[model samples]
Target chain A: MLQTKKWRQYATFYAFVSPWLIIFIFLGLFPLLYGLYLSFTNFTGFNMNQLKFVGFSNYKTVFLDSESMYALGRTLLVTAINVPISLAIGLFLAVLLNLKIKGLSWWRTAFYIPSVVPVVSTVLMWKFIFSGDGLLNTLFDKLQLQPINWLGYEYATTALIVMLLWGAGGSLLINLAGLKGIPADLYEAAEIDGASPVRKFFTVTLPLMTHILFFNLIMGIIGSLQIYIQPILLSGKTLLDSPIKPNYLYLVHAFQQIFAFQRFGYGLALMWVLFIAILLLTVLVFYSSRFWVYYETDQEV
Target chain B: MMVNAGINKPLLRVVVYGLLTVLTIIFVYPLFITMANSLNPLYSLSTLLPTAFEWENYKMAVTTIEFPEYLKNSLIICAISVPLTTLSSALAGFAFARLRAPGKKLLFVIITSTMMLPGIVTQIPTYILFHKMNFIDTFYPWLLWGIGGAPFFIFMYRQFFSTVPKELEEAARIDGCSTFRMYATIFMPLATPATWTTVIMLFQGTWGDFITPFMFLRDEHYPLATALATIGYHLPDNPNVILAQPSSAAAILFMIPTIAAFFFGQRYLVDGIAAGAVKG
Candidate 1:
């Protein structure tokens, strides 16, 4: 009777969990492996049965292809710049909002409202701002300053970065949540020790919040690398003719290759390269966390 | 919050208010411009207000982008996907947290690790898989995976379910409640916050989603986000365009539901995010 009860429990467990299991296996794991397989074979997405196993040729092409190489470099540069600046701005806003102020929720809502607005909308608004005859240039004209072409090759990446900064409030909200998690006692202790507000922030708050910072850092790197829609929406004519714009990042390149050029095998291979880069970067971050990230549990220990 | 006690109180108040006001303007200005321009096709950068209130932009957006069809597809996807995803995610969470299923840890690790994987790595193969199964072009690719595919949601749910005291489940089990019964009758009600969190999160994600629909769906089946993006892409090529009136209007229409969702669900959204941040 006991053995049968255990068996029944096991069966129920499987029944309860099999939905996620089935989906993960079929939709997640199977496809990932198939993608790896397709990366090896020269499949142009025309016919599955016509796949030709080209061994390491696709990987070679992804590395050697000029557009792919430039895209990788450009994406890395954007990620390197965008992640830190955005996170800094987010942290700054979060610190400000953590104060004892009225309408705090309203302020947060106002800030985060842009984040929830559709990306297409945000991109559209920015497109108007950056257009030659748009808001910024119009302002410059009134100031009697030379009108710089914001969407030109010189400023395209900068335009993308500026546009991305508008949604920094999303990360600010996350950082606010992180700030809230820090125990009040830490700040009190620092205060009793006669620490200044700046000192207390550095010693008590920043240290305690490093884990959250780490989380955001990892997420930021991953997210910034996969930027697709903004570039696609903003590029307009630049990307259609030449896929090598400063704003034409990695995922956009992969997308144009796969969907636009019908280079399925090549696109998948490029993504695999992207995957490896992200994994390495994430691992580096994780490995480096031992020095900076702190836990209250560590203090207790 | 209490750290500024030593400073000049009145000065501090002024600084805080000043900072908030400036930030609020910075945040809301572009949106205000967009909303104003959406209503005024004769938009110019010189004035923040429109010369005339014109309904033509809205009409133009509707006709040019097939706004109604896109909205219908988005609603259909959200309506079907959100509830199914939430329910399955909760079930998975309950099983992982409350039950003694073997290999649960390993399975969960596999799921969570997918978060680190570049999404595009899986995109092509998943597309091909759906293609092979003839699930492409239909809503099946979205509905199926949406219901059971969110490892992050499952993780969130598991974290929540773990917090429910074991005594409640033990008591429920003593009354001969089946696992499903205990989950349904006892634990699910307690998981309301988690459910709401998942609902809002998944709703926003599905609604704002562009890549999936852009890649998979035909023009007839495109969501509002994709349709608007596609139109926005081609707008500059139109020589007849003077002020991006139709695009601005399309943007406003696309943003309405999300803004409404934010206003209605801000509390749950913030609470959910706080819970994730605290626990994770």
Candidate 2:
């Protein structure tokens, strides 16, 4: 009877999670493996029956293609600029608010609200502001400043950076949580020692908050690398049309290769290689994290 | 929260408040411009505030597209996807936390590892899969994805469930409560915070999802979010001459639901981010 009951319980566990199993196996895992297969075949999306295996050529093309190389370089540059600069602003705001500021919730709400606005809406708002005779130019005109086309090639990346900083509130919340997590006694001791606020920040706050900053850094890099819709919307272009060359990030380039050009095999290969790039960078970050990312652990003793 | 560590309080207070006010304007100004310009097209877009209250811009925006149908489609997408994804995620999460089955540990690790995988890798194959299944241009993909259970939410629910005191679960098990019943009656009631966090996130995610529908659907089937791309294309000949009037009105309308979600779930949302970050 006990054996039967155990079997029934096990069956029930499987039964309860059956939906996830079905979907994950077929949709998640299968598609991932199938993508790898498709990358090796010269599949132009429409030619399923006439699929010819072309080994390693698609991968070679992804690496050798000049536009693809440029896109990768651009994406890395943007990610590099975005992560530290945005996080610094976020940390600064968090520190400002952590000083027992009046109306803490109100301050938080004001800051955190923008980050939650749908990316589509945010993009549209910025696009309109960047339009030829948009509000921004009008403001510039009022001040008698030169009203250049804010949406032009030179300023396109600048526009992206502005949008990045606008949502810096996201990192603020995380940093604030980290700030609050620091023990009060440390600050108390710092105060008793007559340490200045700046000294206390470096000695007490920064050391404890390294892990949170590290985590934010990882997430920000990963998220920024996937940026596609923003540039597309900002340029007022569709997925089919290429954004201005400066705005062409790797994902957008890969997307155009697949959908616009119907280079399915090439696109799949492009993504797989990009995946490897991401994995390698992530591994490097993990490897280097030991030098910078501090963690409280058993090894501390 | 630390209040004092030999900082000059009054000087810091003045400086902080001054900077906070400036930051507030910088953050909220563009949104304000959009809302203000949305009011009336005839007025200049120069002002910091709304010049006129013209509700006609919105009505015109609606008439420009198949607005009602797309609105219904968005709602239906949200209705189907959010609850289904939330529940399935919770179920899987509760099981992962509370139940014992062979290979469960391995499966959990695999699912969580996908978080680090660049999402673009599977984009093509998943599109091909959906196309083959004739799931293209339909709500079928959301149904399947909802059941697939987003790994992030699963982790969130699992974390929430794991924190529940063991005695409560054991007492219920001793009372002969089935695993499913224990999840629904005991754990779920306790998991309301996680549920709301997951639900709001799911809702916002579904409501604002453009890429999925952009990939899969025809123009007739686009949701409110994707459909907005069609509006204010009044001058196709001069693409640069974007009339920011009715589009801004529409943009504000599109923004309302998500801004509402933010207001409603701010606490849970913050907690969720903090939880996810701490795990990382």
Candidate 3:
């Protein structure tokens, strides 16, 4: 009787969770493993049945390919620059917003509004901001300064970076939550010990916020590397004038390889390379976190 | 934790307010610019403000972009996907949180690991599979995310459901209720906050997604994001002009729903994300 009851209970459990389990295996796992296999073969567009398995050749081509290498370099450069800039801005805003200022939620809402704005609209706003005759140049004209071409090939990347920083409010919210999580008694104790505001912030605030910062950093790096929409919107093929070349990032390159050139095998191979790199880099970040990431529980023990 | 600002208190307040005001302006300046540019009759940069405000630009944008169709498509996608995703996630979350299941921990770890697999790794095969299944150009690929959405929401729901007191379930069980009955009647109603959080997030995500629709759907089936992006990128026959008024209007129109959603749902949105940060 107990055995029958146990089987019934197990059936109920499976019934509750089966939706996610069944769908994930069929939709997610199947595609991922199939894609991995495709990376090893020359699977051209619309020719799924004729895939010729060429072991290691696709990986070899990806490594030696100049365009692929350049795309990777550009992606890394973006990750390096954008992630730190976003963190600094986010942390700075979080600190200010935590000051118990009046209309705190209103101020936060204003800052965070941009981050949640649809990407299409956000990119459209940036297009005007960086346009030759747009707001920045209008300001330049008012100040009697020469108008610089912000979207020129030389300055396009910088313009894109500035646009990205406008969305740092997302991370600011995370950091602010982290700040709020710190116990009030720590600050009280610090004040009792005669620590200055600056000292209190450095010793108590910064150390406690490291884990949040670490989380944001990992997310930032991962997000920046896969950036597609903004760059594609800015420089992608459209009916309007063409943007100057050399603005294509990794995803765009892979996209063009698959859709534009019908090199499905090469595109999948590029994706695998990106995947392996992300895994390694993520592992490295976790490994390196031992030195800087703080744990209150660890200290207590 | 309070410190005496002394005579400098007012000055410090002024400084704080001044800094925040400036930052707010900086944050929202582009939006003002977009609105201004969209209203300008001549579509000229000669004046920062519109010399003549024109409603014609908005009309032209709507007509040119088939804005109604885009809006309808987006609403349809969000309506179906949100409920399906929330239901699936909530059910699964409840199971993992309360039910006696074998290999539950292992199963959860596997699902969570899916979060790390970048979409690009699966993009090609999924596309081909969908194509083979004749799902391209249909909303099926996106709508099907109801079943196989990202594990982010599932993980979040699990975190949330785990916090609910187990006595509620025990009481429901002692009353001879079925497992589904207890989940639906007792637990789910209590998880209203998590439900709202999941719905809002899923809605926002479905609402904003461009590339998926851009890839899978035809022009007629385009959602708000893809429609707006394409129209903004390719506003016919006006390349050199900085702010093509019609396209700019379209952009503003695209922003309206999302901005409204954020303002109304800010509390839940913030709480949800913060919870994720804490738990993840």
TM values, all candidates? 0.95, 0.94, 0.94
Candidate 3 pairs with clashing backbones: none
Which digits, one per residue and each the tens of the lDDT, describe model 2 over residues B128-179? 8888889998999888888888888888888878778999988998999977
For candidate 3, the per-residue lDDT at B38 reads 83
Candidate 1 vs candidate 3, DockQ winner: 1
- Cα lDDT over the full model 2: 0.81
- Model 2 misplaced regions, further than 4 Å: A1-13, A299-301, B1-8, B42-45, B230-232, B236-241
DockQ, candidate 1, vs. native dimer: 0.60
In angstroms, give how far residue B27 of model 1 lies from its true place.
Answer: 1.3
User: CA shift at B277, candidate 2, in angstroms?
Assistant: 3.6
lDDT of each: 0.80, 0.81, 0.79
Sum up the clashes in candidate 3. 0
- Candidate 1 per-residue C-alpha lDDT over B125-230 given as tens digits, one digit per residue, 9 for 90 to 100: 8877777788777998877876574778888888888888989989998999988999999889987877888888788888988778876788899888777766
True-vs-predicted CA distance for residue A100, candidate 3, Å: 1.4
Candidate 2 lDDT at A205 equals: 85
Q: Rank by lDDT, highest first.
A: 2, 1, 3
Tens digits of per-residue lDDT for model 3, B1-280: 5322221478877877898999999898788878888888745663465566788888888886678998999998888788999898888888887777688889898877677677767867888889889999987876677876458777887887787787877888789999889888988887776677778767777898877777788889988887877655343586544336777788888878878877777777777767766656
RMSD of each: 2.3, 2.2, 2.5
